[model samples]
Target: MAFRCQRDSYAREFTTSVVACCPAELQTDAGGKKEVLRGFHVVLEDTLLFPEGGGQPDDRGTINDIPVLRVTRRGAQADHFTQTPLSPGSQVQVQVDWERRFDHMQQHSGQHLITAVADHLFGLKTTSWELGRLRSIIELDSPSVTAEQVAAIEQSVNEKIRNRLPVTVRELSLDDPEVEQVRGRGLPDDHAGPIRVITIEGVDSNMCCGTHVSNLSDLQVIKILGTEKGKKNKTNLMFLAGNRVLKWMERSHGTEKALTTLLKCGAEEHVEAVKKLQNSIKLLQKEEPSLLQFHSLTSTWISCLFPLSRKEGDSEFMNIIANEIGSEETLLLLTVGDEKGAGLFLLSGPAEAVETLGPRVAEILEGKGAGKKGRFQGKATKMSRRAEVQALLQDYVSTQSAEE
Candidate 1:
């Protein structure tokens, strides 16, 4: 089953005879998740839709006005999955998603151009490429690529685009001697039959089965976004081509404008303003802990509850404050709070008071904690009810005095 997309990249729709219509089965994805899609896999004699392969996604469109969810390639045949099944021997109109197909063409061709330039200029070979949803990536067989090298490579690619180089397609036998002429990448071990060669005028010629634009001008433009370190010490270069680059530019300008307005500064002063604002916040946070306060509740009890910016190990700090407040016989309860209405409590001092009153306070505050003979610790919410702690200690003192 020869594919129509391979013969003519611009074929939007074609009436093809359905070879078979098989019922959908549970398909497992890369993550080992099974999904049962309600559709049938309609195999056509010839397909206009390209299947997912070669680091490119599948094309989506329609078959006889029914939405095509996915297209998959199996050996020599391509299957179009749709809800409405087409009868075998019947002819149905198959339409390819033109916008999606052309977008893929632009990025795929852009990748070849960049890959060729990278190899030619800096001896960096393209190990792999992926056509992502938002941007495309090419992994280069290099530990690192400098900024200057990226700028040069991007300049060369855009120059070729502006030159409007004619991109020609050639077919060669897999065993042909011309296979050695491929510059950047190697062929797959399982690849068979005739190899499709994509030639970028005088720039590059490589065996690629993915769709490409007829001319470099169709790419419109190419922009290298950034690079990251990938597996095996390779450099993955991120890029966008044609309309994607324009879309990114629009979004970037919009974000810059929003930032300038928010910071009350000019566009050029945004970085400075943000840095100053961060420093101011750090200064305020540093002064917050100095605002701590202590109060003596009764002869045998003390309360140390203060609102400060929350930090790690706050329980330990509160415990230290409790020990500072009174002797071993005295009852002490220390609490730390934040502006966001969160608090952690620490109780230490007399054995009887801590063992009995500790769990009582925890129950009243709706919190939990644990410690040894004369200490208990835990966290609680509702910092606004801080006054209730003082009243509890006062009542305990009054009861003790009355009993004596």
Candidate 2:
């Protein structure tokens, strides 16, 4: 058996390494101007940077005081893009941001755990995978899986995370028996070179090009957000892991607290209280027509007992209330509050007639509004001049009578 160099494949195992320096220069492209060249791109080197490939984002960090913006693969070689120019033949110390790296590892490993469980439990294969900022999505080869199945998969993956199964990375030739014995998805057969296989002991072994955590325990939890139908025979799944799950929980708890306070109820009573409040609102709405009698009586009493002079705001409110009372050919003018600002509405006739006069009324009110089928609906914010709105309404009524 011929031994190939394990340096590049094993770079992820080490936290630090040395990289070659290359010159960087600024250049313009189709989009516009940009800072192009700052650091040297290493042509051939053993580095821990996972280059952007296979639907995974590239790792980012500083290398020897120079910020490494991106890592990309050109054929079999990994290229590091940096912010500062590096001298030719200069040795640069590299440090991978372990937090970011480990996060990727957790997510990547969590993907394997869930995918393996899905395949074992439901015979559904993961066709594609994507790691996002807050969540990851996996496309399954099956058309649909029941909610129970998804829950089971989630539970199983969490169980595996608790088990802390060792994640082993092995390199082998395409024709090796060890590779053939693996029961998971294989990489493209036409590619020439060593094949990288990530094996989750006693669980799964799949050909992959992404870096992952060393143990399943590193993934604190795998929470499935949801699943939806994809293509004809595929389903897409969204999930969160580790710190992301914690963050989600924090936000959820905060929202619950706010809702509880706003609703004036305890956390446990919130759901029932909301249901009761909704029912009460519905019942009140049903009784609103009857309530109009009292409102009309009150308006008349206020008009007679107080002042005939109406504020624009009160006039607007009376008009709307009168319209809601199913009145037609009735004039409502009432004023409330001070002169600086007030609310007003002008309604005449039944719901239908009010609607017919809506456009003209809106013009008079200097406001925009819409009504159901045939009801006038509008409001005036400033009531400094209530007489203007009343005059407009009277003119609109006169125009309608003439048009008829």
Candidate 3:
């Protein structure tokens, strides 16, 4: 049995009797917190609100002035989940959200047209699709779709729309031979009643259960945003239809105006200006390594003075020094920030010696750090005690030499 919405997509309001109403709990995100909402599952004798199915979402509507949060199909019945309960056998006025319903109709029917055109023009079969909030996507089985193919597909689709192709729906029994001719993945396991097939006159026919526009011209316009790489061996084609295209244009124009003001250039020069700015940034990054260099200490170990701002911490400079002068044969006791007061220190040397002496150095320097393998580092509040930390490391080196 077809629901009222499925039979007539334009139906906005209707009166129906509640066949059953049962308690249902819905978990919803309220102010970013997940909370369970108590509601009721209402089964109407006939409904104008479409239940969620296919690649489309459920329709928003009201039953007796109470909001219907969700609708789901169970077997052949459409279950309207609402916060307020209606009495069984009581007649209630139901009203569909026409704005939301019409937007969905445009996108749903638009998908059929695109899918058909893509399949006929190119052998790209739509494995799956999503009707996202702002845009819709059709995932094709191929790994990539070139710009040329997308342009041709878009052109052909719009041409058919201009031709004003009639979009019609028909129901056939499960055993009907015509069912074999309609394109579909296969019927759902719980599917009941006759199978529904949507056809665009002289274009293509597909077996789908979602509500759609009555004609191709009702789509207004379709804008193929671009293609994105999907899961391995799949390509997702993103697009906007009807009012969504206008919404996207409005947003894009606002962004363009903002960019023009920030860049001090016209829209035509924005790309070149951005490219030049990016190149300047890349050139600056190339000179960053010159910030540190190896200075020979009395023990022939490497030392470096950090001249960068305090906000730019010493970790990257210290790593660059360590990488340049391998720590196996020499020790690196590096300090950053003020020379006589608070600062940061890093002590890198032989693993065994560092593991044994790193913490003691941190203690003298009045900071904490952990070490693995051959590196120990931490902040130092008492950088005035740097002499003591140096003495400790020198003593360890002297003792090791004496033993050798």
Best by lDDT: 3
Write the residue-wise lDDT of candidate 1 on 153-256 in tens digits. 99999999999999987778767888887653565665555778889998999878778899999999999998999899999999999989999999999999
lDDT string, candidate 3, 254-316, tens digits: 999999998789999999878766654554355355423333332453322222223233554
Against the true structure, what is each candidate's TM-score? 0.69, 0.62, 0.70
lDDT of 1: 0.78
Model 3 earns a TM-score of: 0.70
lDDT of 2 by residue, 155-262 (tens): 999888888888887878877988877755555443446777889989998777777777887788889998988987889999998888888999989989998887
Q: List ranges where model 1 is wrong by over 4 Å.
A: 26-34, 183-192, 290-404
What is candidate 1's CA lDDT for residue 153? Answer: 95
lDDT winner between candidates 1 and 3: 3
Q: What is the Cα-based lDDT of residue 294 in candidate 3? A: 37
Q: Rate the local accuracy (lDDT) of all candidates.
A: 0.78, 0.66, 0.84
- Which candidate number has the best TM-score? 3
Q: What CA RMSD would you report for each candidate?
A: 12.9, 13.5, 14.3
